[model samples]
Every structure is written in C-alpha cells, then in structure tokens.
Target chain A: MSEWWTYRPSDFLLFVPRTYYRLLEHYGAGAWPWQVAALAAGLAVLVALVRGRPGALRLALALLGAGWIAVAWLFLWGRLASIAWSADYAAPAFVAQGALMIVLAALPLRAVDVSKPRRLGASALVASALAYPLLAPAMGRPWAAAEVLLLFPDPTAIATLGLLALLPAGRRAALMIAPLGWCAFQGMTLWTMGAPEAGVLLGAATVALLLPLGRTVRRRRDRAARDRPPASPGA
Target chain B: MPTTLDRRTVAAGFLAGGAAAALPRVARAQAPAPLAKTIPSTEEKIPAVGLGTWITFNVGDDADLRKDCVAVMAAFFEAGGRMIDSSPMYGSAQAVVGAGLEALGSPKPLFAAEKVWTSSDGPAQIEATRKLWGVPRFDLLQVHNLLSWEAHLDTLFAMKDAGKLRYVGVTTSEGRRHGELEKIMAAKPLDFVQLTYNPVDREAEQRLLPLARERGIAVIVNRPFQQGDLTARLEGQPLPALAEPLGATSWAQLILKFIVSHPAVTSAIPATSRVDHVRENLAAAAGPLPDEPTRTKIAAEIVKL
Candidate 1:
C-alpha cells in the first residue's frame, strides 16, 4: 500500500544522488543520514539474497551500485570534493572508485554457491586490485601518501569472506580459509607498498596464484574418477 | 537575302531570344550560392549564419506543429546553412528538432549543439540528447547558462573520451554572467562558448571576445538582435549606404555580418519563425565579411539608427 514498496532498485540508485544533494545542502558535513540510508539498502540486499529472491537482490544491488557511483561522480565533479582537492586530482579518484563499485555491483555474485562463495569473492578482489594500475594514467599524480590512502579494500569481498568464515568448520576450513589467506597476503602487500599501483600488482599476483590451484583441482578430479568402481552390468 | 528575311527568319529569331531568356532562370535553379565554410563534421559547407530555436520553439502551438517548423529548417539548410542550438529548458525544442530531422529524411546536420541543465541529470540528459537528435554523437554540447556546470562537465568529459561528443562548451546570454563565463574559459579547456554579442551589447567585446580569441575557443553569438529589440529600435530607419560595400542587402545581413566578422565568432544563431527571415539571415553568408574599418563604420551606423 505504500509507495516505497513499489520502488525499484534502479530508481533508488538514481534517486540517491538527488536526495544526497538535498541532504548535503541541508545537513552540510553531517552525512549520517546518507550513510544510514546506504546501510539500510545494503541490509535489504542481504535479506533478499538470503531469501533467494535473486530479482530483488539484483534490483537492490543496482540501486546501491548506481547510487554510490553517482555520489562519487558528484564529489569528483561537483562542489563537495572540488573544495578539498584540485579538479584534476579529485575527478580521477572519484571515477576509479565509482567504476570499481559499478563492476562489483554488476558481478554475478548471487549465482555463486554459499558453500563456495570465497572463489567468486576472491575473483572480485583480484579484479579490483588490477583496476588500480589502469586508473593511474587518469589520476596523473606521482604515487604519494594521499594517493595511496584512496585505495580501500573492496567492501563486498570483505562482507562475503566474513559470511563464509562463519559457516561450519568443514566448509570454513577448506573453502573459506584459502580466500582469507590470499586476502591476507594481499593486505600485507598493500600495507608494505602503501601505493595504489601496489594494489594492481597484488591483483595480478592473485591470478598467478589461481593457476596452481586450478591444476590441483584438475588432478583431484582425475584421481577421484580412477578410484570409482567400474559401472556394474545392468542388474 | 529578301527571302531569308521572311516569316521563317522572324520565327527563328523569336525562338533564339526565348531560349536566351530562359537560360538565366535555369542557371539560378542549378547553382544555389556557395556556402561560406564547410563544417568538417559533414560533406556540406554550411553558411556562417544559423537559427537558434530557444524561445520561439516554446511559443509554438504544439509539438505536432514542428512539421511546419521543419519547412523553416529545410529552408535554412537547403540554402546552405547549418547549426541549431537548443537546451532541455527550451521545453520540447530538442524533440521537435529531432522530429524535424526525421521528417526531412535525416540529412547530415553540420552541427548539433545542446546543453545539460541539472547537476544530477547530467548523464541521463546527455543520453537523452543523443537519442532525441538520432545522432550517433553530438557535434557540440554546452553547459546551459552555467547551471550545474561542473556536473555536466564530468559527463561531457566521459562522453568526449568515448567519442559520443565531439566538443564541449559553456554559454551565457544577455551579457549577464560575462565575468563568470570568462573565468570558466580561462580555467577549463573548452572548444566553444556561446554568448550575446551585437553592436547594441558590446560589453562582451571588451573582455569576453578578446579572451575567447586568446584562448582559441570558438564563439557562437546568440540574441544578436537582442531578441528583436535592436530591430525594433531601427524599424523606420533606411539601410545605410556603407552596407553596400559589405554586400549586406538588409539590416539583418548587416548585423549578422558584423557579428560573424569577428575572428573569435565561429557562427551566429538568430532565430526566426518565418522562412523569409531564414533566407534573409542566410544571405549574410554569401560574400566576404566586413573589415575593421567597415565594422567600425557599421557600428557607427547602428548608433545612428
């Protein structure tokens, strides 16, 4: 019966920028209202995913995805972020973050099994890691503390790994730990370099790491086939 | 000899004279005047003058009336003129222009310029503009009157990188924000800037025009007659004899030629609701532009009018 029930995720994404502008103008520096709205939307998406309503989840993801992109774009090009940094610096950072969010949101994360969510999460993590180097050309700044501070870990990867680790031990120990270990290695690398380019190098390294794991999976499959008893004659 | 001067000879002479009389008419139909410049966007070399469909398109009967408007547009284009400037705030002008283009068989327009008005609607607005014009990419897009300009610039830059837009610009009219417009021209990398500049409103000549020249930004003049205000002022006045040297047949051509003569001005868009007016505007693009002394004399004459 409420208008909010009929709202779609895409609409929410578009609506957020307009709402953010008004709220930012009204509250100015107090961005709590925007953060709360974003959190609520994220919660709704989580609920939809748990309920197996893929359509709802997608729409919700799209909304938050586009909304975040719009916000980043505004900060990059509009008055808010332009006040703090030069247009040249602010704009590229906004573009990089917005592009990362859109790609993450559009990814088919819902299709991955909860039993093996870490694989998909790791892939996203690697993809975002590699995206940094490509973004450097646009940023046009030498790697500095301020530039390095802009590279934040993919939040979706963090959320997915956290959920997977909380599952039963057998699933957690075998499936979740591998991705967690990889992420830890990546985190360590990022800590040492403290530059955006390092994030890209770490991502490239993950792809190299996945190659050996793929071969192990293939060998295990072959071994399992050899051990299986020959099919009995029709009895 | 006496026999040759008889009825047959008289008939032959009459036919030859008729053919000679009809030759000029055929030549006039065959070769329309050559355009001043060919916009690199298309094969057609467009005349330097064009129509700006802002306020006039809004006052029309309805969107469907654009069918008639297409004829007005066709008159301009068919006469070797191109370029049409519109904005979203101009109500259904973009849609009407789109319709007109479709009705006219979608001839390759020399230049299509539109603007994004709202900060939040920048991307959608650009997308909508592309769709409305049925153009693969717009030749030029400006931030209308500096409204939400920064937001529009972001979308524009992305579009430009993707080759969805060829050029980006900003505009101001009525000489209201010359200061702000000048600042943007100085700070931002722009291809063009639209503003009001006529003999009547010479404020832009002092700074904005010179700055555009220095910056290499093309200028598109709008409200050249102050939306008919200058024409009203010169209503009863006869054409000055000095305009003859510039090949300006009427006050319209004289005024337009003056604006287009400026090195910074790429083109001038003066809107008209009638086909005759479009023809009159197009005539300014026919001959060589006014020189410095000629321009000064034209300005002095306008003061007298």
Candidate 2:
C-alpha cells in the first residue's frame, strides 16, 4: 500500500467537474421519467411520514428501502463505478442500507410521536431529495444533469436520513449510520472536485445530525420541568 | 569450416532486414521527428514526450467521451508520441485506452506501458490488462507505487528472462517512497523507473535522478505538470523569455520542456483530455530544449510564481 500521507484530497479526484456532471447527465438520460416516479414516491413517503401511523410508517420505510436498492444497483454500481473505482466498495453499503430498511419495515415497530419538530426535519429531507434536481439548473448544468431522487445516491441518502429522523431518538440514531456515512463520503467527493453541491449534502448531514440532538435536549427540558417543584405564583 | 548460407536464404534475410528498417523510418518521416532518448539497457529509442492516461482517459462507456479520448490519442500519435502510460488504479482508463487504440486501428508505434497494481497473481492481472489494451504483450510493465514490489519485480524479471516481456520497472508518484525506490533501483536490474518529477516537485533530483543515471535505469517522469496544478498556477503568468528559445508557446509545453530537458529523464508523460493540449504537450518533445541554465531560470521563475 502507498504511504497514506503522500496523498492529497485532489489526488483522489480522478475526473474533472465536467466529467462528473457529464456522468450525471448520462445517468439522467438513461433513466428518464423515473425521476417523476421517484418524486411521486418521495411525496407518498412524506404523506405517510406525516400521517404517523405504524402502517404508513412501514410503507414510507419500504419506499425508502426500494429507493436505496435501486440507487445501489442502477446508479452506484452501474453508473458511478464506471468513472470512480471506490464506488464499487460503496455500492455494497447502499445495498446493506436498503436491506436494513426493508428488514425494519417488516418489523412490528411503533410510530414515534410525530411532533412538529420531527415533521419539519423529516419533510425537509424528503423535500430536499425532490428539490435536488433544481441544483442542476442552479449550477448551470442542463436538466440532463439533474440529480433525481432514487436515481442518484445523494438525494436518496439525504431522503433516507429524513425518513429515519421520524423515528424515536434511540432508534433514529441507530438507523442513520449508513446514510449519514454515505452523505459524508459523497460530500467529501464533491468538495474535493470543487463542486458546489457539497454544500447541500454537508448541510443536510448537519441538520440530520443535529435533529436528534435538538430532540434529546428538548426531552431533557421537558423531563426537568415535570420533575422540579412548582415555583411560587408571580414571585 | 563454417557452413555457407544458401543464396535464397541470404536474399530472404536481406529482404526481411530491409523491410524492418524501412517501415519505421517511413512512418517517422511523415511526422515531425520528436526528440528521442535511448533505453540504456536495450539502446532502443522512444519519443521524449509520452501520453499519460491518469484521469484523462477514464471516460468509461460514454460513447461520445470515448470518441473524444480517441481524438486525443489520435492527436498524440500524430504528434509523434509513442509511449502511453496507464495503471489499473486509474478506473476504466485502461479500458478507455483500449477503446482509443481500437478506434485508431491500433497504431503500430504504440509503446504500451502499464502498471500491475495488485498484490497477488501479478501474471493474472497482466493478462487481463493485455486483453483490455488488445496488445499481444505490453512494451513495459511496472509495479505500481512499489506495492508488493518484491513479488512483482520477480514476476516481471522472470517474464523478461523468458522473453515474454520486453522491459520491467517500478513506479512511485508525488515523490513518495524515494528512499525505498532508490534501494530497489540499486538492487534490481530495472529497465525503467517512473516517478513524479517537475520544475516544482524537484525532490527527485537530489537522489533518484542521479541514482537512475548511475544504475543505467531509464527514468520516466510522471506528473510533469504536477497533474496540471503547476500549469494552472502558472496559467495566466508570463511564459519565461526562455520558453521562446525552446519553442514553447504555452506554459504546459514550457513545463514539459523543462521536465524532459533533464539529462536523466528519458520521457515525461503529461496527461490531458483535450486533443489540442495533447498536441501542445507532444510539441514540447520537438524543437530546441532549454539549456541547463535556462532550466534553472525556469524553475526559479516558477518558484517565484
């Protein structure tokens, strides 16, 4: 193995930014109207997530699982691996994430209280996945380069994080491990390429991470409020 | 007493020798004769500027991009470049290069150089690489970045001994592992050694270059523009007045001219995706090279930048 320190981040950026965008364009061309299907799926998952019933939650989870599997096979393995060797290694993780989500969907799980904060965070993620295609036009790339939900990893990973965020704190953190890691990897890759999309991914990751922390802190405050003695009225 | 050769046999032998000598010369005369440096071990010459398929040729199965890569390769060969270096570590680059060669009708002058990066089954990897490039055998095979160097070198040397391989070498980039590279160069009978060397990344000059000369191992300079960082940095800057004397119009050509001008450097591989850039890079191998003093000034000017 090479001495690790000898490598800089840019050394790993094998393809240029234009090459990367072209890859997206290529994938988008091959997988058309599927973007429409993915967006519809994202909306269905959002409604199910907002409904906060175990059955609806399971449907949402199943949709996310199917999305992950599709991205793992079609995008990561079939497309990204063509240009980046490391995509082969990351593809398996996406498969595992999909498998785990599918398994979780089958399990008899309770829907966590869909509090206002949880709903907002979860909605943002699904919305982000659906809105991600806008980045193509925003970045001056043609619609052919749009990163669609379930058609690309970034949106899929981000959307998965948003879905998992709907769970109770303990289980939510546990389920987020893979998609969070993927976000970091993809974010670093885009950052190294000097692509502006890094901001979107990294920002989503930050919100995903802090969503749990914010809930935990709020829970602690509620617990303290219940445990403490009542204060003197108007004192 | 020695047996006399038959008249028919002598005539056939003469004809074979004449055809072998005449073909390459005829081809060379069609293009500008880029400066060539001889391999110390074999006395065979290769053009001083070679094409590097790092990120440039990793276009995968995109038909348009593959066609573009072929155009770049066509331009490179048209400019008299022969040696094209690539590694399996560069994703899909070997396959893309194969596509380019096939599209170009497999140019006769291709000096196919590839690196074996796997730790086990070196021969298996080499065979797979051969099928990818559609070549009978590689002109040179290198142990990439010194990974499993001991085992790979033994395999390469064995292949050379068996006449299945023409040359054996090892590569390291970004000036990493020079101490170990020097050790390998001193101990093994290497025909070529590829390492990162440019005006700015001159760490190779202190020992590796001199050691290559002493050991009679031909040096192939990689990252001749620090993988385009040097050129990008020096892009808007003025080309040193010395560049005109050396016939370098662009900074990329000037940097290439500087890299290849070193007495120890046999060839400098500059990777580029653009066909025009490949032509510009190959042009550096032609015309007058910068003198020692001019090279120093060029380096100093770059350092200042």
Off by over 4 Å in 1: A1-235, B1-46, B59-64
User: Residue pairs in steric clash, candidate 1?
Assistant: B38-B45
Q: Per-residue alpha-carbon lDDT of model 1 for B1-305, expressed as tens digits?
A: 01001223222332433422321111112124424543322323434687788645533223334544665666666566668888776655676677666655555544788888854778887788779777777878999878777778888878888878878899887766677788999998888889989887888889998988788777889988877769878877898988887787878888998998887677899987666787778778667688888888889999876
Candidate 1 chain A has its poorest 10 consecutive residues by lDDT at A142-151
TM-scores, each model vs. reference = 0.50, 0.91
After TM-score superposition, the amount by which residue B34's alpha carbon in candidate 1 deviates from its true location, in angstroms, is 6.2
Residue A130, model 2: lDDT of 83
The digit string of per-residue lDDT tens for model 1 on A1-235 reads 1233433222111111222223223322333334445445445545544554445544544543454344445433453332222333534543544354345446554343332344444434423433332343454532221111112223323333333322333333443342344345434433443435445444544543453355458779999999999999994
Native contacts conserved, per model: 0.00, 0.75
State in Å the error of residue A71, model 2: 1.0
